[model samples]
Target chain A: MKNVQRIWTQGVALFGLSIIVGIAYNTTRIVSVPWIAQPIQLVNEMDRILKPVYEPSIKNISIDIAKQLVDKNIPFIDARDDEYYHEGHIPHAHSSGDLIKLTEYLDIAVGLFNPFVVYCSDDDCGSSEELAYQLQSEGFMNIYVFKGGWKEWNASGLPIEITSNE
Target chain B: MNKYIQLGIRLIVGGLFIYASIDKIVDPSEFAKQINNYHIIPFGLENAIALILPWLELFTGIGLIMGIYLEGSTIWIFLLLISFIALMGQAILRGYNIECGCGLKEGQMIGLAKIFENVIMLIALYWVIIQPKKYFIIFPKTELEE
Candidate 1:
């Protein structure tokens, strides 16, 4: 019957459309940049929205920080887990990850108002910078992140203080 | 029965598909992750599924809205609905916690409620398809008295 033929044609058409739509949508994403993942940025201006939040800046410190630390006896904190800190960490550094508890450890290690530097696993890890931000939020005026973190320190053969808090 | 209602439903459903596809087309990575999380498709097919499906939605949607190919577009919409339902049902049965990816963005959980909603909509569409007499479209059956 004519109706049966029409049904068959419609079914075939629908099947074809499904395939076409599926392919087109996927291709659009493959060509897009990573910025697409951050949808919130689209709704608000990045700088204005992010400025008040704790962030790291270039002037946080330079290489001479080591001499400064030795001279002023500045405190160093490791942001990785206890295992990484035990395996190796900056000499005289303590391990801390939760930003809320940085001050407790700081109090035990170097007392309030002492300059502090925090470092984490690697460049890809944002934990160090995040911890630094939390410190700033808590009114710890002189906080910095050793951006190179543990990987950079170990890779460059820097002197490490070994501890066995195991 | 009036003929306008059937045409109106088709246009509304088709337009919805086109509008929905736009956001996904703009960002496929988010949608791709959603598709993978459903666990209905293998990881390898995620990219392919993400690539071109939106265009099909847009095209079919527009075609239906325009009333240029009502019969063809209705069929396409039905098939799409069935596949979506199947995919959702399978995912639920398998106990996958995932965003359906039917709507915009990733990490938005779509559960059995959405699947059920689609089923009802598909049924309505099927009713319209079978008996278009209650609706109106640009094209109507007529004769010159041949």
Candidate 2:
């Protein structure tokens, strides 16, 4: 009984301490931070994880559509960072990865009417969706996020381009 | 058997949690989305869990390693393991293939592999909790409160 009581006491104390500290810390970051992705944005993330149908401008496409796009020489944007792109990327995917400069990149890479696919390192990385959203918000239509991303591309042994020498 | 084995277990488990906490601490929004994918917790609480869980994991880990509140930390860690197994198991059953949000590793861990991983961790924690004796404990024994 005493051991149980002691554990309860410590547990309550520790839990309370954590709540107080966490709220105090996170509240400041959530309110003031421009770059920090805030918690409010997470509420609908799962719902949007699958193909988003609500927005006519943006959609999710399968590996095959991405392949067709590649074969047709349609535009493709690599959502991953510069390092990943330089290492190796889809044969001709362009880097428009910087969040701040994405719209500028879209202007340089393709016309507003051109349909293209965005992909990152893998499905788990949200950068592709982030890029697609950025494209949609910037008034471009026909953006498809290749959720399987580069992992699937490389795994399938598709043609790859390496900007850096081995 | 050497009592130091328990200390080693404490350090290993605690170290694991601390390591897991770092990425989640830096990227709670992604972690929260990972939790939301399970569809187990209500939507409103996801943000709260995202904000607090890393700190709880970190403190519980520290408490275990330092033996500051051994009984409490072990109980909490055990409870965590159970919830992890339950959540991952349900996600598998429901067929939502998503990341485990373990925060230590890159890439998505889905399906049976994730459940099996949680089960392994649960077994390890059970061993820590059911030790016959403890050595180098930092907390005062209840009897000493007299």
Q: Which candidate leads the pack in DockQ? A: 2
Please provide, for model 2 over B1-146, each residue's C-alpha lDDT reduced to its tens digit, 9 standing for 90 to 100.
Answer: 54666778788888888898888878776677667656666535766788888888888889889877777888888898788888878766654435688877865566687668767777877886776666666775534221
**Predicted complex 1: CAPRI docking category:** incorrect
The residue ranges of model 1 lying beyond 4 angstroms of the native Cα positions read: A1-166, B104-107, B132-146
Which predicted model would earn the best lDDT? 2
- Name the best candidate (by TM-score): 2
TM-score of each: 0.49, 0.60
By summed lDDT, which 10 consecutive residues of candidate 1 chain B come out lowest?
A: B137-146
Q: Which lDDT tens digits does candidate 1 get at residues A48-162?
A: 3222223432123433454346345567778776777899987778778455576877766645444567777664454465556556656665566666677777777777889
Question: Residue by residue across B1-146, what tens digits does model 1's lDDT show?
Answer: 23566666776788778887887777665556566555445435665566556666776687677654556667777888999899888866754444577864433445788788789869978987777243333432312101
Deviation in Å, model 2, residue A93 alpha carbon? 18
